[model samples]
Target: MKKLLISLTAAGILAGCSASDSGNGQEGPPETEVKTEEDPVTTDYLQERFYEGMDYDAYAVEIQTWVDKGQASISDTVKIEGQEDVSADIIQVADGFLAVANDSKEITFIKPFASPEDAKEYLKKNL
Candidate 1:
């Protein structure tokens, strides 16, 4: 009789401990983190289009003008290859903008002499 009682008590303790160890007493599958991979072509396009050197203020004004005209829109973030995702002031012209102004707020415009169609082709290939 004593052994039966002791076994029952041990089982109860084990059950309680196991339940507490599991999260919040909630019965459901464990939570998982979802990671989305950035497209390499898009990353390359952003890096190639917007770089360290270029006229930011001029581009900003031009882009803002386009935005006012409803020809463009300013967006929030872009994922660049070889760099962490950055919050940038992105001007979308036509299919996409030729530059971006990053966190430093310095905008980098399109490669000096590249045509808009060239930029568009570069982005359109894998997009």
Candidate 2:
């Protein structure tokens, strides 16, 4: 009985010493935390690439505003190059006009317009 008690005591001591020694009296490597920023939802995301010397950021802001205020709704149909009439809403942004479908599924950029009027005329003829 005494030997068994001593063996248990030694086992307990060894276990406690090993656990304490594993700490090494020092801190571990600092934990790494990752953070991420979500991109704003807007039709401007469809812009493939920015044209040189174009103020695309301002244009993106305008597009975002139009979307937020529900100003992007237009009841008109525009003819696709070869497909049937597609009902699309139009918005004029810097350097061009964007035709966004009712479902917000498609966006077409018509460029070379000095103003919204010019884009309207182009739409009239094209559709």
Q: Which candidate number would show the highest TM-score if scored against the true structure?
A: 1
Tell me the TM-score of each prediction against the true structure: 0.31, 0.29
The per-residue C-alpha lDDT of model 1 at residue 25 equals 59
Where does the lowest 10-residue lDDT sum fall in candidate 2?
28-37
- Give the per-residue lDDT of model 2 (tens digit) for 42-67: 23532433222324333345445544
TM for candidate 2 is 0.29
Error of 2 at 79 (Å): 8.7
Residue pairs with clashing backbones, model 2: none
Q: List ranges where model 1 is wrong by over 4 Å.
A: 1-51, 77-86, 97-99, 103-105, 108-127
For residue 21, model 2's alpha carbon misses the true position, in angstroms, by: 44
Q: Cα miss at 112, model 1 (Å)?
A: 15
